[model samples]
Target: MTTTPARERTRHEIVRQAMGLFQDRGYSAVSLQDIASAAGCSKATVLYHFNGKAAVLAAVLEPAAADLAALVAAADQLSRAAAQEFAIGEFTDLAVRYRGVMDVVQELIPFIQEMPELALLVADGIRLKGFLAGSDDPLEQDLAGFALNGLTAECRHADGRTDEELHRLCEAALNRLFRPS
Candidate 1:
């Protein structure tokens, strides 16, 4: 379903509230009523804006997916270290920009992995599959190494880790991933 300009604000509210609900509780744990309550709207209102929970999830995920693709596109020109730095910086920036959306994305990993088609969608559209796939380092070709980012995202809520700390952590992980083998 498409969102019209007039209803865009409401749509944004619903998605934003839903994103928070997803982060606080796991995606499956959140119901439409839960989101509506958090959004200060009725369930019917949310349903009116989005067909269902999945549609809400789609709306929330769409931009993040696009941003991941943009990250991949931007990393295409740099050296291995440069690309890793860029990817880590952008990845951390994305997490900060999206307001807990990383929680949603990380939570979806199991479902994405279980469904090959969904996995392909994430890999192609989200670009998280091969975060630094084009890097000069062969180690960067593997998606598993990127899990460190997910862990970092999950734990970043803890005290003492500033945004700079998160970036440094991500960058260090990138370096570790691309370390000479």
Candidate 2:
């Protein structure tokens, strides 16, 4: 059965509240009661909306997962230069856009193998090997990987910076990394 408007509103509230908690404090540290309290709802209401904390995590991750999936798909249509531009630049923008979730994502990076959604999000990882025009150059692969991790880890609170500025910074680093000896 579908949820009523009021119920759906409550559910959205619960998810929003839970995401804030999960981002503020690691997922392991957040409790259902905390979400309910933050959302101004009862524990039972929170449960009625989501079966458990894991479901809330899934809801929180859905947007980023979708964005990542789309980025990977778009990168498929292009190779090498285009792939690098799209993957690294867009990914850096994504990190800044979802500043709250970035910390949670960082925490989950290690256990991505256990989370199929995250695995799917990071599966191609700009490599696209066996997909389309895959690169075999170790240097190209290493630089992309390095840029991905470096950008995500270093930048989250982009309060004073613009998205274009961030992308420009990432592009600069990528150029340096992809530079030939």
Best by TM-score: 2
lDDT of 2 at 98: 72
Q: After superposition, how far is residue 89 of candidate 1 from its true place, in Å?
A: 3.5
Candidate 1 lDDT score at position 139? 60
| Clashes by residue pair, model 1 | none
What is candidate 2's CA lDDT for residue 155?
59
> Per-residue lDDT tens digits of candidate 1, residues 71-126?
87777666655765677667667666664666676777667555443443466433
Alpha-carbon RMSD, candidate 2:
4.1
lDDT of each: 0.67, 0.70
Model 2 CA deviation exceeding 4 Å by range? 1-4, 124-134, 138-142, 157-164, 179-181
Measured with C-alpha atoms, the lDDT of residue 114 in candidate 1 is 57
Clashing pairs in 2: none
TM-score of each: 0.72, 0.77
